[model samples]
Target: MKRDFAVIGLGRFGGSICRELSMEGMEVLAIDIDEDKVNEFKNIASHAVIADSTDEATLKDLGIKNIDHVIVAIGDNIQASILTTVVLTDFNIKKITVKAQNDYHEKILNKIGADQVVHPERDMGKRIAHNIISNNILDYLELSDDHSIVEVKVGAKMLGKSLIDLDIRANYGCNVVAIKQGKDINVSPSAEDKLKEDDILIVIGADKDISRFEKHLVVDE
Candidate 1:
């Protein structure tokens, strides 16, 4: 099904999402207070409008309630972001993903019933840091302050060792949720499944535990 989306605040973050959604053939309504920003997405988005999203009347007039997901990516202006989110929640919007400026901002957005909150810069920094620290760590996705899901490339250190042999859950306190060997994926991989070089492990656990798993299991090239 083609889901409709409304992205308020046409800054770098919101603009990127608007473009991506449009490219994916999804209907998107791009809203921004600045005329110039709205104009940039005029041809790219299904609808681009210069309107203040925080204003309840403006949002209702644009039929934002019908959109399946709404992303609030208002940059810097915390008040506007919060106000827009409150308005959306009042309208009973299904999913609201907000880009928060800081920890405090994220907390408030959560309290206001935001479906998802993203700290882009902070998260990207952590991802890069993890990649720099290990050659086998392919990607790091933060689930919370404590937990994360990390995709790691199996290396020489773990070659031929089965899940039971390593006892990952007991040893590193992380779970191997899946294993990807080229085009094939073994979801919920069994204990008897052996590691092969270049295989990717989709691991989920506490951040500290994931770090431990990476340090000991993934070979540093």
Candidate 2:
């Protein structure tokens, strides 16, 4: 089934979401107060309109109630972001995700009933920082405040060690969810499978445990 999505605010973050959803063959209504921004997405989105999302009447006129998910990605305008979210909540949208500018914005969004709040810039910074800190860490994803999933390249310490020999779950408190070699991925890697150089391990665990696992196994001394 093709899900219906509405993305308000046509800034970089919102624009990116609109593009991705449309590319995935979902029905998307791209909304923005800017005429040029609306025009830019006219060919990409299922529908694009220059409408103020903070106005309840305008949203109702756009048939926003039919959208399965709404993303409020208003850039910098905290007032508009909060007001739009409040209006969406009043309409009982099934899922409302908001882009938070800061911690205070996130708190308000959560209190106002936003289902999910994302910090794109902050998250990208963290990913880049992780990539820079270690040559082995290829990517990082934050699952919660204290938990994360990371992609770590199989380093010298991990080379030739089988999953049983490492006993990662018992020793490091982490799980090897998958392993990637070249372009192929083993989603269910066996316990006897041995690690090879340049292979990537997708590990998930609490932040401290992941750090410990990385320092002891993935990172070179």
Clashes of 2: 0
Per-residue lDDT of candidate 2, residues 70-103 (tens digit): 9999999999999999999999999999999999
Give Cα distance to truth, residue 76, candidate 2, Å. Answer: 0.3
**What local lDDT score does residue 108 receive in model 2, on the 0 to 100 scale?**
97
Model 1, position 202, has a per-residue lDDT of 93
Candidate 1 whole-model C-alpha lDDT, 0 to 1: 0.92
| TM of each candidate vs. truth | 0.92, 0.95
Residues 62-163, candidate 1: write the lDDT tens digits: 999898999999999999999999999999999999999999999999999999999988999999998998878889999878999999888787788988
Best model number under TM-score: 2
Q: What is the lDDT of residue 29 in candidate 2?
A: 98
Candidate 1 structure, TM-score to reference: 0.92
